[model samples]
Target: MTLLPGVRSATVDTDRLRMHLLAAGPEDGEPLVLLHGNLSTGRFYEHLMPTLGERYRVLAPDMRGFGDTEPKALDATRGLGDWADDTAALLHALGIERAPHLVGWSTGGAAVAAYAKDHPVASLTFLDPVSPYGYGGVRADGTPVTPDVAGSGGGSANPEVVARLAAKDASDESPFSIRNVMRALYWSPTYRLPPEREDVLVAEVLKTLVGDDGYPGDHAPSPHWPGVAPGTRGILNALSPKYCRWADVVDLDPKPPVLWTHGSADLVVADASPLDFGVLGASGAVPGWPGEEAFPAQPMVAQIREVLDAYAAAGGRVTVEMFEGSGHGPHVDAAHRWTEVLLAFLVSA
Candidate 1:
C-alpha cells in the first residue's frame, strides 16, 4: 500500500484478466520484471524498485489470487504454466517485445523458471526459490515417493494459519497470526522489518484469496500415509510435484544466464523445513511417518543445485550466491548486498 518515491501504480488489462502492478523508471528503458512469491503482492518489492528502476523499467505485478489482481480461478493442473502465460500476456499487453530480465522470490522463483522454460529471457535470478521439482512429496533425486504425492499441496497447509489468514488477524496475539508468521518465517528470526513496512506486508498478505480458488486451494483424500493429496485447483496445488516441475528449463534453446541466490538459514524451503511432512514425521509431529526409507525429507536446495547444474552443463551460464545467516527472504534481509550482486550480474548477462 505504501509506495516508495518514484514508484507508480497501474492497472493493466490483459486478455486473461486485469493485473495490478507497480512500476518505475522510463518507459523506454529495458524492461525488468520482478515476481513476488506466494502470500505476497508486488508491493513486497517496493523497496527494491527504486534502485532497479534507475536503470531499467521495473515492473512487479500481483500474481493471480494474490494482491489486487482479479481473483481468477487458477488451474493447478497446468502447474506454473498459468502464471507463465499470464506474464507473457502482461508483457505483450505492455508492448514489451524484447525478453526481459527476471527476478523471482520464493514461489515466484519457480514462476520465473516456468516462464523461462518456454520463453526467452535476458537473465534469471532466483531468490531462495522452491525446488525445481516442486515443494514437497519428492525425494532428494526429485522423484515422488508416493504415487498420490501424499502429505503435499493444499492439505499440507496448516489449518490454523489458513484460518488466521482468513480472519485477517493482524495482531500478533497468536503464534499463527499473520504478523507473527511473517516475523518468524518471512525472514531470519534475528532480522525485523521496520514497523511501518511490516504493517504494509501484513496488510498485503491479508488481501490474498483463502480457499479452493486461492491460497491453499483444495485437497482430496489420499490412500497414502499422509492421507491428503492436492486438489485440482488453487495455489498450493499448483506447487505440488504432481503438477509443478521446472527442471526442464535446463533444456531451453539460447539459454539465458541464471543467478541463484539463497539464504543459508532459510526455513520455509529447507530440507528440514517444519512445513514439510517428511520433516514433521521425522520430528514425531506427524504420526506414522512411515520411516525415512519410505519417505525422507526433501532436499530442496540440493534439488535446485542439481537442476541448475544441469542447466550449466547444458550450456547455460549459472551463478550461485549464498547468504549465510539470512532466512527465506534474502531480498528483504540482505537488500543492499542482493541488489549489488543482481545489478552486477545483469550488466554481464
Candidate 2:
C-alpha cells in the first residue's frame, strides 16, 4: 500500500492481542485513536490520518481479526467489550496515560461507545455508527423480532459474499466480489475511489480472517422468517443484539461530549437500511418478508437518535451533523467537509 508521508506501520503487543497499527504525528502529540469498521483495517484511515497528525498523535489499529492483528476469535457474548478492552490495552501498553479522543466508523463506532462506557475518553466521535441497540432484527425499542434475535448477526451475512471474501476474489465481475462490494456499498454510489486507493482498500479488506471465528463468524437456524440467529462466536455475532447492547451509555459516569456525523444517504445504517434483511424482505428484495409486524425494517437511525436524545435529556452533550450527499463512508465521499467538521469538533472539545 502507498502510505502518505510521515505515516509509519508497527505492531504493538498488548496483553490481549498483538495490534498492528498505522500511526502518524508527533509521539507526544495529544492522542486520537481512530477505529475502523468491519471488513476494514487501519489502512482504511491512511489518507485521513496525515492531516490529523499535524495536530494530534493519530493511531489506527486493525482490530483483532482484521489486517495484521493476530487472528483471534471474538467472544460474541461480550458484545463490543472484546474490541473495547483490546483498545484500552493497546493504549495502556503504548503508555498513553491520558484518555484519547476516540473516533469510530461504522461498527467501530460501537466499539468506541463500549470503550467510553468502561473507560475514560476525551470525547467520542461516531462516523455513521451502528445503532446504539445493535444492527437488524430488532424493533425501534430494541426488542428482538424473534426470541432468538433471528435475521441478525453472522447468519445474516450473505453466504455468497462471504465466500468471495474467503476466496480473496478481487474481481468486480459479480456483486459478491470484494471489490464490487466495496465499490457498491462502502462509499456513495455516485463517488468512486481512485483506482490506486481502491486497490489498497480492497487489499486491506482481503486481510480479514475468514471463518466461524472471523469476518462473518457463525450462526444457527431459526424458526423466524429469515431463519437464522447469531452463533456464539465471531465478529458478526459480536454485533448481534443478542450480545451487543449499549443503550445504557447515556448513564456513563463523566459523560463525554459526543459528535455524531452521518450521511443522509447512508444505506448501511439507515432507518430502512438496504443491508438489513428485514428491510430487504419487506421491500420484496428478498422473498418471504413475513410483513412488517413479524419482521419490520429495523429503524437503526431512529434507535441511535433515541439513545442520543436520551443522553441529551440525561444532561450529556451531543451534536449531530448530517452530510446530505455522502453514503456510508462520508469521510471518503465527502472528505473536505468531513475533515473540516471533524477538526472543528476535535479542537473545540
Candidate 3:
C-alpha cells in the first residue's frame, strides 16, 4: 500500500521468512527504522509514518506473527533477542551496516536496544517504557523466570479500568485482558480507518478478538531472522517468561541521540525525571505516574532515576520528556506533544 510521503513497501525474503519493510524515500538517504510494540505490527504506524517520511528515509517492518505477515511454523520459542537478529538481517539484506537512528516503542524499544548494543545505530528514541521491562537479556539456555511485571501497572493505576478488564474473558479472540484494557479507547472503532482514523478503535478490537487479517498487503513476513526457522520456538520458550522484569537489560552503551517521552499520566512505565533522561536537564522535577503499575511495582521510578542519574553523570546523551493527560503511547494517543518532540528529535538529533 502507499505509505506516508510517497514511501512504499514490499515483501522480500532474507532467508526463510518473508519480510515486509517500508520502501519509502531515497535509497541512499539517512535511514530510520520504526519498530512497533509487541503483538502489534508496523501497520499501526500507517498514520504516523507520513510525519517522519517528510524528511527522512523511513522503514517500518512488521515482526513475525504480527500485522500483515503470515504466521510462522510456531515451534513457539521466539523471544526479544530474535527480534534484534531480525533487525540485523534486515540491515544486512538492505546492505546497511552502519548505524541509523531507531525509534522504537514498547517491546520494539527493547529489540532496537539489543540491535544498538551490538551494531551501530545512530541513536535510539524511546517512548514510554524503555524496554524488556527488566526481564531482558536472559540467556536462551537459562532457566525460565517470569519477569517481575508485578509492576505492569507502570507508575499509575486506573483502578476502575483494572476492575472492569479483570471481570471478563471478552472471548479468547481479544484475550479478555488486552481487549478490555483497549476497550476504553473506543466508542466507534476502526475498520477502513483513516488518516481516516478509527473512533474508539472498534475495528482493532474486532480483529484482535476475531483474528482477522490485519495486514492485507501483498507482502509477506521478513526472513532476516528466521521464518519460524530452526530455532524460533526455542527462542520463545526460553524468553517469554522473563519479558516484563525490569532488571535483565540495561543500556550499557547507547548510540544515536536518545529522545524519550512518557505521559505524566502513564502508570504502566512512569519515566524518570527530565534531568535523569536528559529531556530537560536539572531544571525540571522528576515527574511521577502514581497510577501506573509498571515502574513503581518494581521500584522502576528509583531504578530509572539511578540509570538516568548515572547516564547523566557519565555524560550520556539522553532526553526524558513528559506529557500530561496521556498514557504509554503519547505519540499515537497524544500526537501533538509527541509529534513535536519526535519531529524535533528527528531533525535535531
Candidate 4:
C-alpha cells in the first residue's frame, strides 16, 4: 500500500485558474483527493498516501488560497465556494468526470462537503475536521470552547464568540508543545522545525500568500495557541480573513457518502466546521462578532456514529468512521489508529 510514494508537483490550469498540487499513486487508478487542513498544504498527507498504494490515484492540491497556489484569483476569495470551484475544475482538467472520493480536513472538510454534495464523489470523509460549529473544537461531553485564546474560563464576550472562546489544550501547554514550529512541518508529529526551517516556512507562506490579483495569499492559522499566549487574539486576528460561511453551499446538493470525523478532545478546529450551518449564519471567527461557543461534544463525537448511520440508511455502503482520542487530521495527525480506520472505511466503500 505505497500510495503516495514521494513529492510530485503539477500545475493544472482550469479555464478559470491554475491549481498547484502534490500528488502520488497510480495515475490510472480510482481517484482520491486529499484536502489538507487550514494551516498546511496537501503535503500534510505526504505520509498517509504512500501507504495507500495503487488502491487509488491520490492528488493533494494546494487549494486556491493555500500553499503554492497562493495569491489566489479574485474569484479565489478564500471562500469555500471558490475552493469548491477549483476542486471541480481540477477534476475536469484531469478528465475525472466522476467525482473521486473526497477527504477534507478542517477547512478543507468544509470545502469537500460543499463540493461533494453535487459533484458525485464515490465517498466522503471529514477527517477530524471543524464544520463551522465545533467539528474540531469540542470534547465528547463539551467543555472548553476555545483552544487558543487565554481564558478566565468565563463565557465568550469577544466580538466574535469563537475568538473569546480561547482555552489551551494539554498538548499546547506541554513543554513539548509543537505549536510554535507546526507551520514548518505539516506532517511532522514527533518532529519540530529548527529556526532555519521556520524561516523557510514563513517565507513559503508569504511568497505564495498574496497574488497579483489583489487577493491576499491563503494562510489558515490555528484557532488557538497551544501555550497560553497573550497575543492569541492578535495572532488569530492577523490570520483571519473576512468571514464567508462554507456552510451556505451545503444546501446546493446532498447526494454522496458523507463521513465526518472529529476528536472529542481536539482543540484545533473544534466544532468550528458546521454540520448544518444553522441555516447559514456566521460562526465566531468573523471580526466584529462575538465568538461562538462550540456545540456539546456528545453530538460532535457522534460523527462516526453518523457515518454508520449513513451506511445503515443507504443500504450496504457506509461512509463514516470515528478516530478515537485523535486530534486534528486523524489519518495524518493520528495515523496509527485513524489510518487503520481510513483503510477500513475505504475498503468498505
Candidate 5:
C-alpha cells in the first residue's frame, strides 16, 4: 500500500497481542489514537494521519484479527472488552501515561466506548459508530427482539459475501466482490474513491481474516424467523447484542466530552439501514420475510441518540453533527467538513 510521506509502519508486541500499526508525527506530541472498523485495517486512516500528525502523534493500529496483527480468536462473550483491553495494553506498552484523544469509526466506536468505561481518555470522536446498545436484534429502547439475541451476529453475515472475501476476489463486476462491496457500501453512490485509493482500500479489506476466529465467526440456530444467534468466537459475535453493550457510559464517574459525527445518508447504521436484514426483509428485498411485526427494522441511529441523550442528561458533554449527502465513512466522503469539525472539537477538548 502507498503510505503518505512521513508515515511509518511497525509492529509492536503488547501483552495481549502483537499489533501492526501506522504512525506519524513526533513521538512526544500529544497522543491521538485512530481505530478502524470491521474488515478494515490501519491503512484505512492513511489519508488522515499526515494532516492530524502535524499537531498530534497519530497512531492507528490494525485491531486483533485484521491486517498484520496476530490471528488470535476473539472471545465474543466479552463483547468488545477484548479489543478495549488490547488497546489499553498497547498504550501501556507504548509508554503513553496520559490518556490519548480517541477517534473510532463504525465498530471501532464500540471499542472506544468499551475502553472509556474502565479507562480514561482525553475525548471521544465517533464517526458513524454502531448503536450504543449493539448491532442488531434490538429496539430503539435497547430491548432485544428475542431472548437469545437471534437475527444478528455471524449468522447475519451473508454467506456468499463472506465466501468472496475469503477467496480474495478483487473483481468489481460482482456485488459480492470485496472491491465492489467497498465502493457500494462504504461510501455514497455519488462519491467514488479514485482508482489508486480504491485499490489501497480494497487491499486493506482483503487482509481481513475470514472464519470462525475472524470476520463472521460462528452462530447457532434459533426458533425465531431470522433464526440465528451469536456464537462464542469471532468479530461478528463480539459485536452481537448478546455480548456487546456500552450504554453504561452514562454512568462513568468522569465522563469525557463526546463528539458524534454521522452521515444523513449512511445506510449501514441508519434508522432503517438497507444493510440491516430486518429492514431488507420488511422491504421485500429479501424473500421469506416474516413481516415487520415479528421482526421490526432496527432503529440503530435512534438507539445511539437515546443513549447519548441519557449521557447528556447525566451531566456529560455530548455533541452530534450530521453530514448531509455523505455515507458511512464521512471522514472520506466529506473529508474537509469532517476534518474541520474534528479539529475544532479536538482543540476545544
Candidate 6:
C-alpha cells in the first residue's frame, strides 16, 4: 500500500502478537493511537496520518485478524478484551509512559472503550462506533431481544459477502463484492475516493483473515427464530451483545474526555440499519421475523447517546458532532471538518 509522505510502516513484536503498524511524526511527539474498524486495517487511516502526525506521534495498527498482522485466533467470548489488552501491550512495549489520545472508528470504538475502562487515556474520539450494547439483537434499553441473542453475531454476517471476502474478490461485479460493499457502506454514496486510493483501500480489506478465527467467525444453530447464534470464535462473535458491551463507561473513575462524531446518513449503525435483522425482518427480507414487538429494530444511535448521557451525568466530559450528508466514515467523507473538530477537541482536552 502507498503510505502518505511522512508515514512509515513497520512490524513490532509484543508478547501477545506481532503487529503491523503505520507510524508518523516525531517519536517524542504526543502519542495518538488510531484504531480501525472491522474489515479494515491501519492502512485505512493512511490518508489522515500525515495531517494528524504534524503534532502527534500517530500509530495505527492492524488488530489481530486483519491486514499484515499475525492472524492470531480472536477469542470472541472476551468481547473486545483481547484488543484492549493487545493495545496495552503494544503501548508498554513502545514505552509510552504518558496516556495517549485514542481515536477509534466503527468496531475500533468498542476496542478503545474497552481499553479506557481499565486503563488511562488522554482522550477518546469515537467515529461512528458500534452501539454500547453491541451490534445486534438488542432492544432500545440495551437488553437482548432473544435469550440466545439470536439474529446477531456470526450468523448475522452475509454469507455471500463473507465468501467474496474469503476469495479476495476485489471486483464490483456484484453487490456483495468487497469493493462494492466498501463503496456502498464505507462512506457517502456520492463520495468516491480517487481510483488509486480506492484500489489501496480495497486491497487492504482483502487482506483480512477470514474464518472462525477471523472475520465473521463461527456460528451455532439456534432454537430461536433466526435459527443461528454466535460461536465462541471470530470477529462477529466478539461483537455480539452476548459478549460485547461498553455502556459501563459511565462508571469509569477519572474518565477521559470523549468526542463522539458520526455521519447523519450512516446506515451501518443506525436505529434501523439495513444490515440489522430487525430491519430486514420488518421489511420481510428474512422470513418468520416474530414481528416488531418481539424483535424491533435495534436503537443503536439512541443506545450510544443514552450511555454517553449517563457518562456525562456522572461527571465525564463529552462532546458530540454530527456531519450532515456523510456516511459511516465521516473522516473520509468530511475529512476537513472532521480533522478540524478532532484537532480542536484534542487541543482542548
- The sequence of per-residue lDDT tens digits that candidate 3 reaches over residues 1-349 is 4345675867767664677766566667788888876435576665666766667677788765454544543222234555677777777788876678887776576677667667777777766644343422122222221232121111112334333333433432542344544433211122122433442232322322111111111111323211111112322221232332323334455435767666655544443422111122223332332232222123334454555555566666778887766665676677656777887777777
Residue 154 in candidate 6, Cα distance off native in Å = 0.7
Q: What is the C-alpha RMSD of each candidate to the true structure, in Å?
A: 0.8, 1.0, 11.4, 9.9, 1.1, 0.7
Location of the lowest summed lDDT over 10 successive residues in candidate 2? 180-189
Q: Estimate every model's Cα lDDT from 0 to 1.
A: 0.91, 0.90, 0.49, 0.50, 0.88, 0.92
Scored by lDDT, the top model is 6
lDDT of 6: 0.92
Q: Per TM-score, what order, best first? A: 6, 1, 2, 5, 3, 4
Lowest summed lDDT across 10 adjacent residues in model 6 is found at: 1-10
What TM-score would each prediction reach against the true structure? Answer: 0.99, 0.98, 0.64, 0.60, 0.98, 0.99
**Model 1 misplaced stretches (Cα beyond 4 Å):** none
Q: Which pairs of residues have clashing backbones in candidate 1?
A: none
Worst 10 residues of 5 by lDDT: 285-294
lDDT ranking, best first? 6, 1, 2, 5, 4, 3
Which 10-residue window of candidate 1 scores lowest in summed lDDT? 110-119
lDDT of 4 by residue, 1-349 (tens): 1223464778888865777887777888888898876545666666666776447788888775457774454332343566777789888999887558888877676677667545777777777654332222233432333544222111111222222112221123432223442422233344344655444443433323322232222223334422121121211211122322333323433445456666544544433323212111244333332234432222443443443454455453444555555545455456667767766777767
Q: What are the runs in model 3 whose C-alpha is more than 4 Å off?
A: 1-5, 73-79, 130-180, 183-196, 199-255, 270-296
Q: Write the per-residue lDDT of candidate 5 for residues 108-145, one digit (tens) a residue.
A: 99999999888889999889998888888876677888
As for lDDT, the candidate ahead, 3 or 5, is 5
